[model samples]
Target: MTTFRKIAALAVAAVMTISMGACGNTGSSAADTQDLVVARSLETTDMLPQTGFSNGDIWAIQQVYQTLTRNKTDGSGVEPGLATSWKQSKDGLSWTFNLRRGVKFHNGRTMTAKDVKFSLDFARTARDDKPWQFLFTAIRNVEIVDDYTVRLDLNEPWAPLPSDLSMSASSIMPADFGGKTETEFRNNPVGTGPYKLGEWKKGDYIKFVRNPDYWETGKPKLNSVTFKYVSDANTRSQMVQSGQAQIDEFPTAVSVSSLKKTRNVHVESFPSTSLIWVNLNNRRKPLNDVHVRRAMAYAIDKEAIVRAIYYGQAEKANSMLSKNLMGYSKDVKDLEYDMAKAKEELAKSSAPKHFSLTVQVQSGDPEKSMLAQILQESWKELGIDVQLQTLDSTTVYSNRTAGDFDVAMFEMTNDISDPDEWMQYMFSSSANVNSGYRNEKVDALIKRAAADSNQANRLKDYAEVQQIIADEAPEIPLVYKPGLFAVRDQVKDFTVTTLGEYKLADTTIARE
Candidate 1:
């Protein structure tokens, strides 16, 4: 069997064992009642903060580790996390953070400024090709000012530095935990978060127990949390419906509707910064033609996808940036879904008709599959033979990075509150090797916005950038789906942020 298949088999077996145990149990202990059981769509392969690239990895890391700052539950602002207070230099080149005293790691080690320095340095110099590595490139040096204070000297003024520091990739670890390999770190992670690693059964479930000495007193009300990996959407929904699981992440749209009506099941949806779209390979033929790319944009019925597939749980995306974000432009309108306009645009291209193209999508996501079918049907009407190919996430990402596919359906969420986080990596000529499309003007605007500390100027630059991208159509913006979480009605205070990060420390399980 393939490695993934084997892992899935083992996961199913482990879940069966747990389900049987739960079924056989009598209501005797408070520990059993207080534990929050959640169903996740994927298995977490790594625990190292900087190395994680998937939602599963982030979900695991956020619970075990702590960043200097974190976005508020509403994602409206930032709040103190490990660092109680911080200050930035007038020029914005230097930032100093005052660490929280008496903070203890999972291993009972005291967290200090030195640990913060070590973690930042490690993330900055990581050899792996982590997506967040570029965010740390501006850091000139990390100085341990004292036991409770550390300062970062930046190469240039970066307005989003504080928000960037709040990313999961910037999670602080113990000073002595630096030299361990990725496997070693994943096996035993040490962090200052409210939950500590309890037990990990690979491809099955990861159990986490509350940290008694958590920095925040009287917090983390739940005694334990068990994240069960169940990739199938229907199975995950069934687990929650049968009371086998208390929470389920990324529940299918169909499941969501039914779960909302089910008694004792509470469904919560947050406006996510997540953008779902088709990343066209601009280096390939037809796609490379701006007219053809525009044609594809005009052909897509984004509102229809949002309504039919997402069940009105999502909003049609007009530009690369989501409306919830800072730099999103209401001024730049989406290309209307007009078949006549699409045909006209295509006629202007070198290869006007009889062009065949393969669109790639990840296999498991029902929403993406539906989108692929919709696109196939729409493009087919335009005399284009569109082939839908489904592959695993790893292969799809690899293919995207290598520019091996004609068009790939992908979703990306902004880790920070700034426009630079999304724009630079996705659009900048020097950075976007994935799309392999470069426009000098777009690159210049991104750079200008990145450096300009003035909010108004940065907004103006980003608006222009969005206008250009909308016109050029490197990516066909489809929809922004809300981050959906279904939890038991008894599970209180559990919230998912716009960035899709969960805050579980304040959650509590009410006794029946």
Candidate 2:
């Protein structure tokens, strides 16, 4: 067992007929070497590391980009990536990093302090409207101290800065964008990671070949990787079973037991800081009313969603934050599943009866659609006509950010293991997530927690924040869930960081 498994307050380790093997090349790659095929639930929305919004895009970015600091392989802490070492000031307002020399981007250009400064500065001020802007918002400036050294000047003592820097959003890109136009660079980005883009067909598949000049030696043991767009979870499962794809990510949680029964298939279920929820457009309509929001929350049966969707894999969520997160208060309870209470609350609201509204789901995501249907059926009982709108993941994310939908479904994952990762984006008035779920008290509390160095003080503030959110009902958090992935037995040394980072550098495929 890894250290994180033992120490993580919220992680459960469940494994059957699976063990992580040491990564080693099984054979030399000829043209005949089989590429590892992976099937996922959605087509990648964007290839650029910092801007990609979909799970498909994130999966691809993990393969092609490197951040300055990465989550430790065993879990829950930061480790070096592009930077060999870093030193933080006692005041936490400034930090210096010594970058690894000789590291080359896929374009064969060596990574330098200039690129680091540009990437950090760009991410900090790029687009205030983007959800990830919070990652770098505290950085006052980035200074290129020397050829392989850079320093970050902060506006405040940001404790999450190290973890934030490890995210794909913080990945360093070529300062010159490889001398390509922004549009061209976005379409074909280069990084100092183990894989380089081989081919990308929009709405179809993405191919990544091993980077010949990767800084890490004896890495990316496989010749290449193919991530095929298979939106349906069942088909993704079938693809893995039939050897069409060696791995399937986000395989329906309920199908895991059955999938594990198939020959040579292994199911990996591990703890994660994921909160599945229905995000109400608090800026719109009756949803703006706390009564209506709480009404919808009470109507939905969280237990049924767990049983039907997660099988035996999940626990009903208590509050917006997952149980694993710090300051997850046991006292802040979820609204019980009470249809009658739902009616009372609905009746109390201005849009009492025969009111119609829509809830949007990601078109091909089984979980989102099923969860929406569940909401659709129950919200109807309140005399609320619910319209089900199914859109692609890209549009779903765009609509949410633009506040263009009545309601939306999303399985929110923390980019880092910090409570503020979700707290700021989901509840803070300053966040551009478009939730419109604002409380000046919450805004004040979050502001205090972000700057406070003492965990004790932060925890007290966050607890109050959670209770306030529970009462307000901005989002109906359904479950505190686990991460699920189906892999071929031949794929060896398969492991993800506690933060759910798919670090493939040490992974290899075994011989038949």
- The prediction achieving the highest lDDT against the true structure is 1
Per-candidate local distance difference test: 0.80, 0.78
Could you give me the TM-score of model 2 versus the true structure?
Answer: 0.90
User: Across residues 381-420, which tens digit of lDDT does each residue of candidate 1 receive?
Assistant: 6788988898876678768766799988877777777778
Q: Lowest-lDDT window of 10 residues in candidate 2?
A: 9-18
Q: Could you list the CA RMSD of all candidates, in the order they appear?
A: 6.2, 7.0
Error of 1 at 487 (Å): 1.8
Which candidate tops TM-score?
2
Clashing pairs in 2: none
lDDT of 2 by residue, 347-450 (tens): 89978887888888887566676677778778878888989988877688778877899988887666666677678878998773857887999988987898
* Candidate 1 Cα errors over 4 Å, as ranges: 1-31, 126-128, 176-179, 401-404
**Predicted structure 1, TM vs. truth:** 0.89
